[model samples]
Target: MLNYEGIAASKGYAIANAYKLVHPNLSFSTMKIGNPSKQVKRLNNAIKRAVNDLNKIEEVVITNMGSASSEIFKLQATFISSPNFINEVSSVIIDSKVNAETAVSEILERRISKLKNAGNGKFVLDKIKDIDDIRKRLLAYLLNKNMSDLALIQSPVIVVSEDLTPNDIIQLSNKNVKGVIADLGTNTSHSAILTKSLNIPSIFGLNNISKNVSNDDLIIVNGMSGEVIVNPSNELVKEYSLKITKYNQTEKPLDKLKKRNAFTKDGKKIGINANISSPKEVNLIKNYMIDGIGLYRTEYLYIDSYSLPTEDEQFNVYKNILSSMNNKPVVIRTLDIGGDKQVPYLDNNDSSERNPFLGNRSIRFSLSKTIIFRTQIRALLRASIYGNLSIMFPMISELNEWYKVKKIINEEKRKLDDGGIAYKNPKLGIMVEVPSVAIMADQFAKNVDFMSIGTNDLIQYVMAADRGNPTVAALDNPLNPALLRMLERVVNVANAYKMDISLCGEMACNRYALPILIGMGFKNLSMNINSTLDVKALLSLLDYSLMQKMSEEIIKNACTVKDVIKIEQRFIKI
Candidate 1:
């Protein structure tokens, strides 16, 4: 038996035969085109067909995987129709006199090479897979060749691939595929996102997995532990089978706590809400027994569309989500696009910064394009009549940004009023993600109706470490004493002003962080849909008074994350 370790993306255990998916290398002879005009025409036709194919796939993905995952197809379709991409391919064919397939392959390779040479780092490296997927699909259409489809798998298998694109994962939905193991990918990759949404156990970043694993080899994919055992012994198989059964049994108890409130033994009720990207996810509220939505990521709407969504279109999506919530407070964050999450349609000249994270992003990007910002504000204002809605601005580092955003929102309200549009001004809030903002939390809390600490970015910026970078992942610790002190300050400011505050980052949902957060006086907590039930169950078993004492000791005595964790373990033992 051979054991391999990788990064665990989704949670589950699966034992099945391995099905190797090796992409065939296409060999083509370069031939001068007899007629450039005809070649260009053929290229255009191929692109059109690819766009049409992607559109069909988009609908299927939306129905099966939700709008967030469906965005991958929409993005690919946009790239296919992009004038820059089309013109580049046409130029290659006309200038080099090469066939459509060769021209596309050459141009895509050149573009990918340029992206790498520019030192764009991991973000651009991940995008290379998407471009490669497009190249394969287009070339297949031009070559009149058939590409392997996961939907055609005849039996249950653990899919082994060099890299599974978003489209590949989507096609595996409802198929006999039980798990996924890939040679290259990260937790933030699109393939990982799709697998999690589809509930398929997955592991990534296993180097040379495709070379070592053969077809029909019995494999055990332990996604929770990031372990892959190839041709396991009977003893190991039996052990894993028992572990799977126990894991499932443990999870079943969480369902019983779904109807129960998240209250400590001493009777302190903490609101447990969800963080969602689309309206389709609102259906999970009842199933998870969520109090409300803590964070409604509005960036996906912008990133997924070919153009900016019209006010009415945006209004309808927000209204549907709010109405479905049935009076539960839904905090709608305005378009947080920029930095790593860029939209081609919204691209301006200022996007070529060396460090996009510190450059124009979130509120800075929105304020620069007031027209786009106002349109979203108008939509949220129109949707406010449906349920309890709150507006939040991301990446607010100073007071002026908040004042400017509020001014524009008021201006949008006046425009609506003049047009006789019925709307209400929802509660306004700002995300305390920057250290500068956390330092001024007291002043900012008094101005905004509420505050939500985005611990993900907060820790990243506070520690000067990029969370996505593996080398610095350890530095971006939420349990770090410095981070704890920052949160302590923000919470104290919010409490001092009696403003409602909630922590809406990954930390809020983490079981280990729950006692510290509740002890710090965070009455509202929000996390991913899957974590809600377990967190609620954990909360029910804790005593708030004891957590408060531990929290005090943690903030006062602990000078490092390890010390804080040690304190938490001691409290848990009690």
Candidate 2:
């Protein structure tokens, strides 16, 4: 048996025969170009067709996965339609006197080389793969070469590829594809996001696994531990089979707790809510017996459409989700755009920035575009009358930004009042994502009605590490002493002022972190809908008093994530 380690993108296990997908080499000798204008027209037509294909793919992806994952295809569609990329190809064709395919290949290669040599971080370097995928599709269309048809695979098998794009994952979803093992991709890649949503076992960044495994070799993909076993012995296969059986048996009982309230042994009732992206996820809320919607990401309404969603459109979506929740409190976060998530229509002049995460995004972007910001605020205020609703602003680092946002919201309300429109005043809040806001939580708590700790960005910004980059994923841990201290401070401020505080990050979903969070006095936790039952069941079994004592010790003694893990293990054993 050969064992290889990779980055675990999804959690599961799969044993199946390998099916390799190799890209055919499309090499053509330089042909004497007859008419440059004709070649340019052909290239433009091919680009149009590629854009249409991407749009269709985007619709399918949005239906299968959420809009957040579908952003990958939307981005590709925008990149192909960009003026810079199109102009580069046209210039190369006219100047080099080569065919459209040759011109595209040459320009893409040059652009890829330039980007790689720029020495940007891994987040920027990953875009190279996206550009390359676009090149492959455009070239295939121009040359009339057949692309890989994943639907043709009739039998179940694990897909092994050098690199798989979002388009590839969508195509493979229709087949009997059991799992995926790729040579290149990070846990935050589009391919990884799709597999996680589809509940497929997947491992990526395995470095040339396609070259080692034969076409029909028996393979075991252990996505939980990021291990891929090739040609495993019969004994090892039997061992894994028993392990899978045990896991299924344990998971079956957790489903029974879906309808139960999550309360500690001491009778402290904890609110278990879900973080949703779109209205379609409301069905999961009812199915999981969630308390409410803690974080309703509004960026999808802006990102997925060709233009901004009208106030009526946005109001209908928010109203439907609130009505579905039966008056449960739904916290709707304003549009968190810019940074990695960009909308082509929102910004006309697109330019690459050295550091986008720290740049225009979240509240800053919304505030800059007051007209757009007001429309969403109006819709949110209008929707408040439907059911329980709360409005929250993201990425509020300073007190001034919060004031600016409040000013606009108040203005929108005044407009509604002057027009004799009926609306309710929902609770207002700010996300404590930036370290500055966490440090000044006492002052912020005095102004806002509530605070939701966004641990995902808090850990990333606190540690100065990019969460989406695999190289720095290890440092982006919430258990880090600095991050915990920040959270502690925020919680203390919230308690002193009698303000409502909840943690709405991926950390809340972690089994080990749950005790510390509850111990830190967080009464509300929001996570994915699929995790609500398991987390609720786990919370009910723990003693709140003991967890609080242990968490205090952990915060005082633990300095590193490793130290925190050791402390958590000791408590678990008790």
User: Which of the numbered candidates is closest to the native, going by highest lDDT?
Assistant: 1
lDDT for each residue of candidate 2 in 258-318, tens digit (9 for 90 to 100): 8888998779999998887667778756877778999988986765553467889898998
Collision count for each candidate, in order: 0, 0
Model 1 clashes, total count: 0
Q: Estimate each model's TM-score.
A: 0.81, 0.77
Please, what are the lDDT tens digits per residue for candidate 1 over residues 1-574? 8999887777889988998877765667788977988888988988898888778767766666567667777788898899999999999899898898889999889866765465321224225556777899888878766566565566889999988743566577744788999887654444565576566888887878899999899999998889999999999889988988998899898888888778887899999888876677788666767789998999877654544688898999999999998898999999886655666546532358878888888999889888788889999999999999999899998999899998998888899999999887799999989999999988898789999998878888999976544345557567888888889899998998989999987678667778898898899987777777778778877899999998999999999888999999998852
lDDT (Cα atoms) of all candidates against the true structure: 0.81, 0.80
lDDT of 2: 0.80
Pairs clashing in candidate 1?
A: none
RMSD of 2: 7.1
**Weakest 10 consecutive residues, lDDT, candidate 2?**
118-127
